[model samples]
Target chain A: MTQTSKKPAAVEALGLTKIYGSGNTEVIAMKEVSLSLARGEVVALLGPSGAGKSTFLTAIGLINPPTAGRIVIGGEAVMDGPRALVDLRAFRRRHLGFVFQKANLIPFLKAVENVAIAMEINDVSPRAARKRALELLDYLGVGDRARNLPDALSGGQQQRVAVARALANQPSLILADEPTAALDSHRGRQVMELFRQVAHEHGSAVIVVTHDHRSLDVFDRTYEMEDGELGAKHSPPAPTANSTPSA
Target chain B: MNLAAKDIRHNLGRFVLTAIGIGLLLMTVLGMSGIYRGMVDDAMVVVDRIGADLWVVQHDTRGPFAEISRVPANLEHRVRAVPGVASARSFVSHNVQREHRDEPLRMNVHGLAWPEDNGAWVTLTAGRPLGQAHYELIADASLGLALGEKLKLGKDTYTVVGIAKGMVSSGGDGLAFFTTQDALAIQVDLPGDALRLERAARVQRAVAQDLGQVQPLLLERGAGMASGIPALGPPMVSAITVRVAEGVDAAQVAATIAAWPDVSVHTRDDQEALLVRGMIDKARRQIGLFRVLLVVISTIIMALILYTLTLDKIHDIAMLKLMGARNPMIAGLILQQALLLGALGYGIAWVLGGWVFPRFPRRVLITSEDLWALAVVVAIISVFASLLGIWKAMRVEPNKVLA
Candidate 1:
């Protein structure tokens, strides 16, 4: 029998700890959190307010580093407890993507330009970046709205454009926080399924911090977080186990 | 690809309004400097046009413009006799204010040596210079005296035979050129009542003196025969302008004239320095203060404007940072906008200055050097103003996008 070799992990965090202040002022935002995501995995992080889901996402995204942890992305160590084995900002530019609750598209840039700017910021040539941006927008089903400014787009369209922007650089990991919170259930499910489709087709890992348990079936796996601690992961069909959160 | 340009396009209305506001302020600053240059140029006009190598004035005094100067009318003859002297002419200038067509007309009357000078060196923009001695004169165009127009000065009516442009005093009063005799007569002429009072005073003085009491008939004769008979000796002249012979050192002629105990001598350059450093020093300082104050106000306004603009884009900046945009890219957004604002404002100032400065009451002369200097200063101000915006942008945390 032939044996297929295991693919490399997309992102890995070991013993991640984040404490806000010292002694009397201290508040541990996240404690001993560890997770390893395989390529083509779409995971939903279900948590309540102040549950450290965003904190963990930011830490792994290299936006805000943890007080104690090791982060390895694409099988390469990037952060050793925030010591930065690599140029963190440059590394993030080339390797990570983010989507926020709001579309957060640059108001001045058109839909296509919003996506193109992401690659251009990472040193891609404008022409090539623009071409790739158009392709990503087409892939995300917003190609027809490429010329519209963010203000002119509907909420669902804007989210799709934001996703195109996130995928502009072909990053190894995509992190999203409440990306579909403002959309209706149908559009919300559509966005969650789009994330799953992006992960599967683009071979990138995606971790979404969401309160909408209605779209849990679209996720490959789901983890619940509370009081700054992440619970055990549960596969689909256990969506009711993690209750839907307040908007 | 240029984020600054895109952002400006997105908010063009506000940016243009801000630029215009800055432009008007910068125009004031430019106009102030231009006025200073014009004043200095006006002050030097007479000095330069006189074409004299040396000026001989009253002893121990800076004269002609800086202070009052008086020397014998024959000082020209004395200066002419000096070694290396080419020629000499008497120069007398004094201001006259009189009613012209219901308007108060102020003029700085300059005396030309008649047969020797003929106001030939004066640059006429219209008509001709003095055709003959006595009442024929050359009036600056600014004096509003048309060619062939008659202007009454004292007892005599002088005809304006020529019109010169930009010939004015340091005080900006237009210049009128006349023969030395006519100028002297105008200087000494008194009103009818003042003349009668002066004659009575002279007769009284004569009665008090032994000679006057013995010669009462002589006093009466003197009163009737022009009481203005050089009573304090020969009529005095303001100064003597001397030209040195070709290949003859002006400093040598000046040094020789300086040795005279009764009079002082200044080289042309010395006279110019005296005028600039003495006559209008306070005015220059006041104008300079206004210019600097306007610049400071411009800087503050720009800084505040840029800071507010940064505030408006705080969320966008955070989003860009979270997207991994470098510091240079983020800071460039603000800095480029500032530089663009400065360029646009400067351009507007130049255009507005061209349209408005000529209409100013006083001459406003903007030179190429002044323009270049102002451009450099504006660029520096733009960079400095953008610092506040750049600082705020730099401090923006990428994680704020998540929040």
Candidate 2:
């Protein structure tokens, strides 16, 4: 029988720690948290405020770096034990995308420009970037609002534009920090469902830090974070006399 | 879209207000420079209009405006006798104020030896030059006097025979030209009270030498007639101006005449340099200092505005950072905005200055060279002012967007 090699996970984090201050004032924001996600996985992170969910997201996103950790994305080690293995800025620009609590679109830029600038910064031709932006806007259902400035857009439409911008560069990972906290329940649920669709359709892993639990059912897997610790919501039961578990 | 234009369009109201504010400051700077230019021009106008190749002043003095220059009126003939001298004229210049229509009217009085063969060099805007020198004056139109109006000087009333435009003293006072006799009378004659006071003091002093005895000479002719003594008669001129012969070097002729005691000689270029660098130099420095201060203040204001504007959009900057914008890209945004504001202000101020400065009481000259120089200055200011905003933008943390 022929053996087939398994693909590397899309995202892998091991022993991620983020300690703020030092000595007497030291506070550990993340304590040796480890997580992994496969490509096309849509994972929801549910946590209380200051539960290290943001820290973990930022760490994996290569923004606020982990105090000690190794992070590998798409089989490439980007960080090793608090040291960046590659140029963080270049790596982030090419591989990572983010959506914030607020839409955070540049007020001066129209929706299409907001999306196009991401690709423009990555050295793509302006015409090609703009075309890509238009296509993404169409996919995100905001093509009609492409010419509208952020101030002219509704809250839901602006969030949709922000999502299009995050996906503009075709990043390997999409990290969202409370993206739907400002939206209505119906809109928030719709946004969560859209993230799932984006992850499967675009073949990108997605991590969403959300306080709203109503959209948990939309995620392929869910994680709970409390006091800087992370654990999966569903784990295999421990081995018993009549129980067995697969490796 | 260019980020600066987009930002300006998005906040058009605030951007325009800031530009207008900066424009007002730049206007002050440009206006000061214009005023300084006017002052320098005013100082040289009479000197240039005199049509003189050389000026003879007091030996140690700079000139009329820079110093008091007095020479004997007979020096005209001596100057005319110089080898290269074409013609020489005695000039008397003084400032006086008289009562006119119940208001004090101050004017610059010029005395020129109007020759029979058309010696007047300054242009006449409306009327002819001095046909009859005595009791006939050439007046500046800015004095609010009619062409044929009579102006009183000393004990005589002179009719305005000619109207000249833009003829004025270094101090911007309106001018009147008369013959040497009238200017002498205006310069030497004391007022009624002053004359009476002087006679009284002289009588007292004469009688003081001899106690209780007023001499017949004292009563007859104020005591000077007793000893066959003579009275001072011939009038002294302010200066002598000389025109050089066609083939003569003015500086060489001036150097020869400059050796005479109590007679300082200056070529035309020398006189111009004296008036510009010597007299108007102070005003120029004052304007220069003022321009620098205003530019500094404007720079500070621009920097503050840019910093505040950047601070207002700090979250957006962090979003850009999180989108992987380099520091230079973020700095470029702030810098471009500053440059836009500066260019707007400079353009508005330059346009308004050209329109408004002409209406000012003083002549305001705005040249393309000055505009170009100001453009460069504004460009430097804009770049320098944007540094503060650049610093703030560079320090922004991408994780702030995550938070």
- Best TM-score among the predictions, by candidate number: 1
lDDT of 2 at B34: 83
lDDT of 1 at B238: 92
Candidate 1 residue-wise lDDT, B239-356, digit = tens: 9999999999888888888988999988889989988899988889999999999999999999999999999999999989888899999999999999999999999999999999
Q: What docking grade applies to model 2?
A: medium
Deviation from native of the Cα of residue B284 in model 2, angstroms: 1.8
Model-by-model lDDT, in order? Answer: 0.88, 0.82
Please report how far candidate 2 places residue A38 from its true position, in Å. 1.7
Query: A1-247 in candidate 2: lDDT tens per residue?
Result: 1111134478888888999999999999998888887778878888899999999999999987899978998889999867899988888889888888899999889999999989887888889999999999898888999999998998988988988888888888999999999999777866777787888888788999999877777777778888888865643223334221110
**Cα displacement (Å) at residue B24, model 2:** 1.3
Model 1 residue B268 CA deviation (Å) reads 1.3
Question: Residue A211 in candidate 1 has what lDDT?
Answer: 96
User: Candidate 1, after superposition: displacement of residue A178 in Å?
Assistant: 0.3
